[model samples]
Target: MKIPPHRYPSPLGRCQPEIMDVETTKRDGWQEQHILVVSGDDSRLDFVEREFIRRLGNRLYGGKRHE
Candidate 1:
């Protein structure tokens, strides 16, 4: 769910809305260690992280060495 700058939703409920600013380069993007934020009604960030590990395995997260 990608939101464009010019097309942000107006307002809703008790939650205060503010735009999150981030600087990114094409080479080093989401694959690198960085602060990411999920801005929606659900906790998709947790879901994404879990899915990434599930697909890629523990090495991505540096779990341990199997002997």
Candidate 2:
């Protein structure tokens, strides 16, 4: 199924297109999921985000980057 970019619906903005991602990961026989949204501005889960940071040793990212 394909939705034309022009037909992409965003509940937060003035009809502009936005990108979203649903990620699933498995660890220790359990499945976990997270949704990553990329919009100019929008919503979130503060508590869950904080918990995720805590679980990751308080690091927002654990990868090397080129700057």
Candidate 3:
């Protein structure tokens, strides 16, 4: 079975923010001053711990740029 071009919808008309965000993030690594929004009931213990440590360190020593 083959579908005609007229029957197939073009992807450019689709608007999916989450898909775009993931694609952009993959292309460019995460940056500072950006709000990270996580969803779902999955456990995020490790991420929480790391984020807490980073914030605490920054607060104590000020913002230090790491290459």
Candidate 4:
């Protein structure tokens, strides 16, 4: 899944610090699946989220870059 970067406001209507939550779940006798939740300032989260997506994509697709 691809997540577009977006800002999340606090209860007071102010932008809050960002948090990226990554969860991996495995069902019985099944392969594990991943879920990623991204919340925060769009600018800040964009870079981080893009990096994560790039790395994951590379790994999954057997790209040359790995770091």
Which candidate has the top score in lDDT?
3
lDDT of 1 by residue, 5-30 (tens): 69666566448756554544422455
lDDT ranking, high to low = 3, 4, 1, 2
Q: Over the stretch 1-67, how does candidate 4's per-residue lDDT look in tens digits?
A: 9898897856875566556433332232134334443333335457778777667766766676557
Q: lDDT of candidate 3?
A: 0.58
TM-score of 1: 0.19
lDDT of 3 by residue, 1-67 (tens): 9885675766966765544566466335435446453332326557776677667766966786879
TM-score of predicted model 4? Answer: 0.28
lDDT of each: 0.52, 0.47, 0.58, 0.54
- Residue 64, candidate 1: C-alpha displacement in angstroms: 17
Model 2 ranges off by over 4 Å: 1-45, 58-67
Inter-residue clash pairs, candidate 4: none
RMSD of each candidate relative to the true structure = 15.2, 13.7, 11.3, 17.8
Question: How accurate locally is residue 55 in candidate 2, as Cα lDDT from 0 to 100?
Answer: 55
